[model samples]
Target: MSMKHLKYCPELNQITGSINATILLLQLEYWFAKMTGGKFYKFLDSCEHELYKQGDSWVEELGFSKQEFRTAFSKIGKVYTSKKAFKESKDLFNGKYYASYYDRIKGLTYYIRNDAKLSELFDDDSNKILYSEEKSTENTEDVLRTPQIIIPANPKTSSPLSVEYNKLLTSVKDTHPTKVCVPYETIKALFNQYCPSYPQLTLLTAKRKTLLKKLWYDMGQTLENFKQAFLSAENSDFLSGRLGSWRASFDWLIQEDKFVALLEGCYTNNRRQSQFSPSTPSAPKPHSKFTTMYSHYWDFEELEKLEDQYIDRQIAKYSTMSVALD
Candidate 1:
């Protein structure tokens, strides 16, 4: 029976605790207030709100009580940094400092609860004893090497499976769907160039195939996802690398106060005229060419409606334009 055990994830614990300690402490305070009828076990309030008012400035000028603050801080720090000793130690009835909502006695019995000793530190032994081991489920890597590797699938045979199998495939798992095998030559090349420290034999065809399948499968998925995303983009040309620095093409012009005639013509249109015509009849805003080509492309139909609604005024104004008569 395979079993798994919980070990401290040190990096995660350090990061989470450092950033969330203030929030956790406040939660503890709220719980304490509810459990103990709005009373705080910690003797003094934090300097900011309860004890001192803001903008007084003289409050900070009055100076800190080093002995009192240090005594309280040490009690809390020990609970965080030293878990083993803390879980095993006995609690004192009149400990000088205490964490908020901390249990003083177990199940309301007078017997002291180790969890509450204000100055106590948690030790390693107690933590080790408290943690329990659990069984783990089979994962992809494990499934790949068990039943398949048990009876060395005849690597020497050149059956349909045989052609795909090299000397290295004798140890793959039955759950593995692929008949493909890693050639001995690829393993030899990589081992020589990258991992000479380990015995070259360890990268035998079997192990190499397993490692390569995982690495290649993951890379293929990521690459395919990126391709799909780029394909779905509104500006397909930019993603396919056709408009190379077409993004930066305008940066120099704008920065140097220069303008291209083509861009200006596009923005102003060929005739420097507004597309709206009072008598010619107006479609809904969503259908407007300016909105479609210039503003963020809303659905063309929706743009027509918005334009029409805004243009439908009780008082309409008419304007004239010069048309070239040939």
Candidate 2:
């Protein structure tokens, strides 16, 4: 039987415990090589590291329906053990063989296991010869070439990301690369300690992780910078719900715009004087000259009585003059 297009070892399916998983792994390896310009390995910080792909794209390209793709994708990390004496124990497996990080907005990023059992499968001399032949036939029409062999390095002890991203130090010269790994747990602790009034972060969800990573890269990529940002948030009365109903949350504080505004002291209390403060009572205006000259004669109540009596006399005189005329 001639298997021309896609050549994969049967052992791959056996080890991964699913034919779909084997196909998915091979496909990922093929794309990783293409994305990295024929290189077997590339660090996440490299310019060409935007390897996030939507699941639908994978489904369309791989000719698998959404359900099949999801099932295969989930099984990429699992490693099945060999058949045991008992049939019931045959399906048991050890730790995960891959590490993946899923950002709801950015899609999925994955790394293969760097252990010996999987490495031997790719590093075989036969596999290399097959890969060379595939590379030579690059111009062939409709020919899906076998993927290049990727020999990943031993897994790293300390993971930069969460437990999900453990064991991904793949074939780099520096085993401990100096990438700005976001210490999510430590930052969460700092946020809880400093911004006590804000909502406590019980779970580091995918959305929160995405925001935290963006913030770590955008602002200074250091724990101290994060600490300072949290401290600033703590000091802001507006962020603590003292000045307004809205309070700053872990998510809100780590947002790019809000975090920048916080570091710039935009929300800091300026302690301006209140608008309702009592003003100094103005001095009474000096008495006008006319009032001062006639101050003694100016009796408001007595003048009113005199004016009424004069009006009464005028009325009686007018009455007598009318009687004479008649």
Best by lDDT: 2
> In candidate 2, which residue pairs clash?
153-171
lDDT of 1 at 118: 17
Q: What does candidate 2's lDDT look like per residue over 107-200, in tens digits?
A: 2233333233344457677556445545443454334555443221123233223443223212211222347588899988987777666667
**After best superposition, candidate 1 residue 206: deviation in angstroms?**
3.5
Q: What is the TM-score of each candidate against the true structure?
A: 0.14, 0.30
* Model 2's TM-score against the true structure: 0.30
lDDT of 1 by residue, 1-326 (tens): 32111122222224224212322222232234234322233322234434344422211211123222323233333232122222333432124223222222211101112233311333465333222222336552222122111222232333333434323223322233575443445434533333222223343444445654543332232333222221222122232122333322212212211221112121222222343222322212233334434445568677645533432220121101111110
Highest TM-score scorer: 2
Residue 142 Cα positional deviation in candidate 1, in Å, after optimal superposition: 32
